[model samples]
Target: MITVELTRFRVSPGLSEALLAARSAMLRDFRADRDGFLDARLVRLADDEWLDIVSWRSSADLAASRAKGGNRPGIRAFFELIGEIVSSEEGTAVEEAV
Candidate 1:
């Protein structure tokens, strides 16, 4: 089953654009080469709130990636820009259309 990981967070004041740029760089330079990584998107919800949606082939793939840690330079840069994590969840996709 496909797995989707959703992470919601708020960025430090005046850092939204920096966070987005760092995320883009991380995806382009790092995540794109990872196993089972399907896609990733960063979305702005409110003035400071944001969402990170990532899709993977399976739960194992997500776990493996997590084990590797987001300690790389680009990922670390992105993480540093976040002020707080609102929520994070992972689940299998439902078959029904929205």
Candidate 2:
């Protein structure tokens, strides 16, 4: 199992609602599709920043989804918005050892 952490930042004001709406739509899409995803969570950080933690069965699933255009519209829009704001992304190795 793998997890993907996607974060986005909004600027200029009043963009957070639009971005979050998009996120909600995208989450619905993920829920409808069961093969390519394990689970996903949309999180809000601060007024203009958000994070999406996605769990996948494998990297191949992730790649295949992107290749087949399985990502979300809001996600794409968020990236487009990033070009207008300051944003960064980081992938981490999660250890579930307890």
Candidate 3:
């Protein structure tokens, strides 16, 4: 089953652009190097608050990726930009569309 990962976090005020750039780079790296990256999306919940939704082929893939955190420059840069992480959770995807 596909695994859906949701992470909610806040970035420092006035750093949205940099945060997005870092996220883009990090995603590019993940798609290139990670084994089961399906896709990812970034959404703004409110000023300074954002959500990262990522999809993987299976729960094991999500766990493996989390275990190998921030090992590259892009991923490390993305991690450094977060001011606070509100929550993170993963579960089986019930449905998916293009």
Choose the strongest candidate by TM-score: 3
Candidate 2 lDDT tens digits, 13-33 = 677666666666666666665
Q: Over the stretch 3-73, how does candidate 3's per-residue lDDT look in tens digits?
A: 99999999999889999888878988898777899999999997789999999998888889988898888
lDDT of prediction 2: 0.58
TM-score of 1: 0.86
- Extract clashing residue pairs from model 2: none
Candidate 2, which segments miss by more than 4 Å at Cα? 70-98
**What ranking emerges by lDDT with the best candidate at the front?**
3, 1, 2
lDDT of 2 at 51: 60
- Given candidate 1, what's the lDDT at residue 92? 90
- Cα error, residue 74 of model 1, in Å, equals 1.3
User: What is the TM-score of each predicted model, taking all chains together?
Assistant: 0.86, 0.58, 0.94
lDDT of each: 0.82, 0.58, 0.90
Clashes of each: 0, 0, 0
The alpha-carbon lDDT assigned to residue 50 of candidate 1 equals 92
Candidate 1: Cα lDDT at 32: 54
Clashing pairs in 1: none
